[model samples]
Every structure is written in structure tokens, then in C-alpha cells.
Target: MALGGCANAWAAASSASLPFDDIAGSFAKNEIVELVEEGVVNGTGNRKFEPKKNVTRAEFVAMADRLLKLAPVDADMPSFADVPAKSWYYGWIEAAVQLGIAEGKSKSSFEPSARITRQEAAVLIVRALKVDPGSDTGSGLDYKDKSQIAPWAAPYVQAAHTLGLMGGADGKFRPVDAMTREETAAVLDRILHDNVWSKAIRQTPNMGLQLGWQNGLTTAQFKEQVKNSAVNTLVPRWFFLEYGSTPVSNHADPSLSSWAKQNNKKVWAMLGNHSDSALTHQILSDGHARAAVIQKLAGYAKTYGLSGINVDFENVNPEDRLSLTAFISEFGTSLRAAGAVLSIDVSPDLGTDWTEAFDYEALGRYADYVVLMGYDEHWDGDPVAGSVSSLPWVQSALNRMLSVVPAKKTILALPFYTRDWTLQSGGASSEELTLIQQGYRIRSVAYNRSWDSDLGQYVVSYMRQGSQHKIWVEDGRSLGLKTMMAAKRGVAGYAYWYVGAETDEIWTSLSNAIRYASY
Candidate 1:
């Protein structure tokens, strides 16, 4: 039978054996046993893996050819003038040539009968996988006769040498020596196990060392794998507005701390609207008030191991603009110096000089992040069927701010809580009832916008009078669209003003949208 056909037939019928299976016996039985047990070599027919027979050069070619599973090209066998279509090893020779594992001794001439040397086998095995034959430093492996290897094969020989697979018998590489069947099988098996072919086998490292073991990964690869798996940024936002006179009894709660420390989450201790007039005045009058706040912030950061801080002070006087600026500049410098993140909520005023109550430009320069408070355009005081912040109005405000502030530092704030208004006979009035008291109905919330020709801006639609129906504001769907707009604008990220007041559905939807969002 042809060698290639025999190899294939043998391979098709072989059964896998455990690595530790017993094989000691007669030479023929041992050859078959070891070959079958190691799954390195195979043979033809009934449970036979021809053990003691001297492997022919063509047979070696056929065995190595099976590793690649390459298709034979449609061509005549030209390895040797003696080789013919009827030759027993024709198919194997064709496959070896196709895989570049074996080459002609001369053009159209393969020395099929020549004994394959160990050096020749090494070169062929490395070449089959396109392994780089590196420079001849003669430095790595102290193989005594390394200088005898031909310059063309230096790299391949060096790689095999470094891999500890090429120390020759009798303590010498014996570069020019021919190989025995046993030597060939050992080297070929090692090469196969190392090259990526035996991925499944090598993945089973020291069985107990399950902490880190993967296909073809060295210690460096293993360390890098762990590091890469751990790579993530923690970006928690502390609802600064929420912290107040209410004592936080849950500070020791693991769930709260866990949530804060999770990747892309953090705590922001709310420097809320100071009900204490003394503290409020302290922020305005004392030049060192900023420093005091910075000290307080540093303490907070260290205490909570916080990722950052967010300032949510509301109703500060117009006169405090410069104080606010100085405070922010110093506070930002302190936080950044301490390697903490800082974000601030700001009044959404488009006009630069129109409102000096809060300096947007100065705040932008000092804060790492600035959230545009884009709600409350119409409130309990103003009875109008209009959006809290219309698209055009938001766009206009954004354009004006972009003129002064860097785009990346901005986070478009989407209001989680919507305002409800009562439609009266003559006009509309803001509903005094809290959102939860309204029976949790969300469809009543109309996300409406219309172009106002006179104002030349899109106006939000809300109930203004009788029969127009009270307007319930934004929900997740509307907020998601706004978040997309923020992402498209390349803002740092979207921020929901107050996550507490938001329903589970709203949180789920918005969180889902921005869960993997990149800044």
C-alpha cells in the first residue's frame, strides 16, 4: 500500500489513549503502544501502530504531512526522476511538498530513499510552522558544536536550541548527522506540542495551578493576561445634591461601597445647598474658604477612597461668581493634585454676560467635568406648556458654552425627574404633588417639542390651559435620545441630575445605553 494512503488509513482508525497509559512490551508492540499512547505516530489497519519497523524517509514525510491537513495539488510527482504516480509514497510526498515541510534535493528530484538527518528534521519541523530562524548569537544554548550549523539554518537551529528541544545526543548537536526513528518522533512531538497545534494539551498546565494557564502562554503572557483582564476605569458619580443634614446610616454598608468602587462608578459627596448660613457665608467671605473646602474634599477622598467629587450647590448669590471661580480653581487644583476627579453642576445659561450669577467659562476651566443643568425652563412659577429644556434651546446653550469651554469636559445633564403641571381654565400651573404621589403613570409624560418662529427656537410643549392636559415630563426613552445626542457631541458622558427620583425603568434604560459608552 502507498505510504500516504497507509498513514491516512492508520490515522483514521487510531484511538486516543491517556498520557499515562502503559506501553512497555516487545519492540513492535512497544512502537505501536507508544505511538498510539502518545498520539504522535499512527499506522495501517486493525489496532496496529507499526512500532519496530524502521521509518522510511517517505514515511516520515507522510507522518509530518498529516499534521497540516493540507490538500494535495493536482500535479505529477516531480520530487525525483525515480518517483512515479504509482509510487507507494506519492500522496504523502505531494502533501509534504504542498506544506513546505519537505523540499526537493534538486529541482524535480526528492531523495525519497535518503536517510532524513536530525538537522534536516529540525529544519523541516520549524519550517512547517514558518518558525523564524533567528540570528546566530551562539549565546543562548551552550551546545558545543553550534558553530558547525550552516549559516542558512542558524536561526531555526537557534530557536529549537533555546526551546531545549535540540541538544544533540552524546552532548553535541551533531548538526550534520542523520536521525533515528525514535529521535525523530521525540523532537517532532515536542515541536508539535509547543507550536500552537497542541493548544488543548498545553492548556492543561500543572493541573493544580489553575490560577493562570492558557494556550502557549509563558509566564509573561500569563501575567499580561491577568493585567488585561483587570484593565477598567472606575467612574462613580456621587449625587452631591443628595448629601445633607440627613445622617448617612448606610456608610458602612458593603453594597454602597461596592457600588462606588465598581468599574465606571464613584462616590460624589454632595456639597449641597448649605442650609447653615454660617457655612454659606464661610464659602463666600473667607478667601481660605476654598482651601477649607479643598481640605474637606481631601478628607472625603481619603475616608471613602473616592474616585472623585461633584459639586451641586444651588441658589448661590450672583455676587458669589468670582468667589465661585476662585473656589473652583483652587478646589480643582487640589483634587487633580491628589489624583481625584471633580465634576460640577452649573446653571444652563447661554448668555455669557447675561448672568454673572455663575461663571460658566471659569467653571469649565477649573472643573474636570461640568454638567449642564438643562431643566427648569418652566417651573411652578411659570405656567406654560413647554419643555423644561427644548432641543434648540439646549443646542444654543451648548454652542454658546462650546465657544468658551472644551467639548470633552462637558457632560450633558438629562433630567431624570419630570415636572407635572395642572391645566386650569385660563392657564396652567405647576403641580405641587411629588412624582411618586401621581400613581407612577409614565405615559402621561409627553416629550413634545415645536419650533417657535418668533423665538426662533424649538419650544417644549406642556399644558398651558384648560383641556391641554397637564404635562408629565421626561422618561427613559426621551432621556436615551438626549444621551445619544450628548455622545454624538463627544461630551465626556451623560449625567442624570438626580438618580434617586428616577424610576427603575428609567435607570435601567439610561444605564443600559451608557453602560459601555466611551468618553
Candidate 2:
């Protein structure tokens, strides 16, 4: 009989025959069929599913075991007084308990024969998925009997509802009511086919750009240029800290926000500290100051009709690492409640004084998107000259970053501008130049611009004022290659360091490159 039951379980999972006769033309017929095909649901006996029968705790455990492909536990039999060692559900119940997907009715009583409730099933499924529903007590549920849901199971129920695993009837979520076989099958089918995490990972590509307030571009010009580019999100420098405790607005160009809304683009208010270590440490180290900053940023997002806030606090002290993490966590909670996104920008991992303070893993967990400043391989103050962002350098940095953060939550920040270094006697002083400006300077000097395959950029060397000037150009070709690299790595998307730094021709090239790459 045990062998026969095992054979039936396998057949129910692999065979497509309609074993349940009563489910024909029922609302859950298709779901029942799929679950049977997936081996997650089996008939009670003699090829009969008993669709309307109440599912028992043991039966639900068996279904969860099959659906999750959980490994069977090989320990001594459970001490539940009612569950005998030879029971058919003994192995599955033990496995479920080991996986933390289910618990006994009491320390000594499993009550395996008792009917399972809707909320109970939800809690089991939530535990199986290993999702953190957080500590938000209020269920955003609109069900009439939501108040009756057990406090411990509220978050799980809400999570299951959000994932489309369960639903209510007649504006009521009968939390304590027994779940039927058909309902259980439907829920399992949804869990198998509709994964919420995978859906979030494959969401729309988010191409963005940071706009400096001092870029000197008018609203009309900004709109005309950005609308034609592949930018979907615009982070304009708008707010900063006042005395390290309050937020002050720079008030972006009035027309910028309206234009973004009309063009189906989102504007995120940029909150910057401009590398002020003292100010950043002050606000982050204080609990009240951190709360004030979060509140003020949320208020700004609401007042400006912005989609989110871009946190650009740089040059943070190493001691403030935990404090910064706390601020981001609290800030993220507030932004989530306000229906806004939270994106954070961090420097590259170079083991330098500036980048070592950031906690990449914590920021990845708290922020919707973690933007890596992937440029400035050789900054303006560097002693030696190198590519602004070489392909090898950026790739190495990305690999280091991915070790701590997930690719789906990471964004690569590319530079639209390059640096021109002048080799002088005392020290090398470099000037930041755009792609257009670099091209113009090269042409004016009539210097032969050659492609450096290693750097993936163009290089030009000329002698002016008795000093050798060299520049590694970031034109359309280099930008396209970097964008493709980001896409191939399966990252969220790429963003430009700032607007008004690239030529008109580069925009079309970038748009085609990103669009064709299917990012």
C-alpha cells in the first residue's frame, strides 16, 4: 500500500490525465490541472481529488514539500503523540518542520488531522519563500474582516496577497476558515508560476542621468536635449543640508519637472553633501538629526511631485558607517510609506580614503538602486594620467561590487566628460572637458586622434605652451561599449554623470546602443 501511494504521488505529479472528475468546468479547474502536472497536488484516493474537501495540516505539508522540492529529514521520528512513525505524512511533516515552513499545534501535538486555515496556509507559504515582510503591522488590505487576522500572521498574509497567492470572497478574508483542496491547488499554482522576486528583477530598464544645477542649461535647452536621449530618470541637484540638520532646496528650474512629466520621465530630487565629511558625520551620528533629514526629504519629494530622492552624501567618516546605514534604513522606510524610490550613489571600490567608508551590502539592502561612480580612474588631482574610466578598471570594480551587491539592484554611473592633463614641471593640473570640447581641441590642434583598444577610448597628444597635453576622449564609441558591458552584466541600468557634457551626435549613438542592447 505504501508503494502504491508513492506511485500515485509520482503519477499525479507527472501525468496530465484529468484524475479529478468533480473539478470539470469549475473555477479552479485549470489551476488544479496545472498543480497536478507539477506534482504538487495528488488525489485523496482512487483517482479522486475531492476538490471541495477541507485540506488537513498534513496534506498541506505534503503539498509544500513537493512544491518546494524540499529535502527529506533523516532524523528520529517526530515526537507528536498522534503522528505514528509509519504514517504516510510522517516524512513530509518532519521535512516541513525542519525547513521552518510549519509548526505543530503545540509542543507535543501536531494535530495533523486538523483542517488548515487560510492564514495558516499563507504563513506557511511565506516562510517557505524566505521573504522578509518587515515590521509594518498595518496590512494595506481592504478586506472587511482583516481585523480578525492573527497578529503574527498579518505580515505573511499581506505578503501573500501582494504576491497574488491568495484572495478574499465577498469582501472578507475568512482567516480562520478551513481552506479547500481547490483553493490550496490554486494558491500553489500561483506560487509556482508567478514569482514576485523574479518579476522585480526583470522590471523595466532604468536609464538615468544626474543634472548639475550649475550646468548653465536653460529649461528649454535641457528639455530639448534630454527628451531626445535615452534617459528615463532625471536626478537634478535640488536639495542640500543646512547646518547639517535641515534640508534646503535649490529649487530646480520650474519647467524641468513639468517637461519630465509630459515626456513620461521621472524626476528625482538630488540630496547632496558635496563631499563635506564634517557635515555628513554630524547629521548621520545624531538620531534626531537623521530623523529630521529623512522627514524633510520625504516632505520635499511630496512638495515637488518628485518620484524619489537620490542620496549623494560623500566623504563620510569611517566611524559613521553604522550611523549611515541606520539613516538609510530609516529613510528607506519613510520613502516607501510615501510611495517614493530611494537611490544612493557611492564611490568606486579603490581602497582609498573616500570609498572605504561606504558599506556596499547595507546600502544595497536599503536603497532601491545602488549607483556606482564608475569613472574618475584618474581624477583631476591624480599625479599620473590614465583613461577617465578604462574598460578593465571598470570591469574589475564591477566584479568587486557584485560580490557584495546583487546585479539587479546596481546601476553603473558613466562619465560623459573626460579629463585633459597638462604635464608641467611642479605638478600636473588637469581640466575637465566634455566629449565635444575634446574633439574640438583635437581638431584645432590638428593632432592625430588614435583609438586605444586597451582603454576603449581615443587618445591625442600635442605640445602647447612648451608643455605636452594628453587627453583620453569619451566619445560615442567608448560610451556605447560601456553601456553594452553594463547590460551584459545584467545590471539594472546605466546612468550619465551629468547632462550637458556630451555632444548632440553622441545622444543618438547612445540611444541606439542602449536600445539595441535590450537594457
- Candidate that would win on lDDT: 2
Cα lDDT computed for each candidate against the true fold: 0.54, 0.76
Q: What is the lDDT of residue 415 in candidate 2?
A: 89
- Please, what are the lDDT tens digits per residue for candidate 2 over residues 1-519? 999999988766654457675676457888888878767788877667888899999999889777765433322323366777678887677666543467778766889999999999998888877677776553598999999999988998998888788999999989999999999988877776766533532354344343332245666766766765667787777788768224454666656777788878888778888778888888888898888888888887776778888888887888888998898889989998888989888888888777767889999999888888889889978988878898778888888888999998888988878988898888787999876677677767845455566877667788888888888877666776677677777888777767777766566445434443441
lDDT of 1 by residue, 1-519 (tens): 599999876655443342221222332334444444555466445544333445567767766654443333222213346566677777567555533456767655677878776566667767765567766555664667877877666677777776666666566887777765555656656655555555633342211100111223342443343333211222233322113342111222234435436533344544554433344445555675456557766666666766566676666666677877777788788887777877777767844432455688888888987877666666557757555655556666766777777878886765645555655666776653322433243324443543233332322344433344444435433454455455556676555444334443443334322321221
What C-alpha RMSD separates each model from the true structure?
A: 22.8, 22.3
Off by over 4 Å in 1: 1-255, 262-264, 275-282, 350-355, 432-439, 442-468, 503-519
Supply the global lDDT for candidate 2. 0.76
In the predicted model 2, the residue pairs found to clash are 13-39
Candidate 2 global TM-score? 0.58
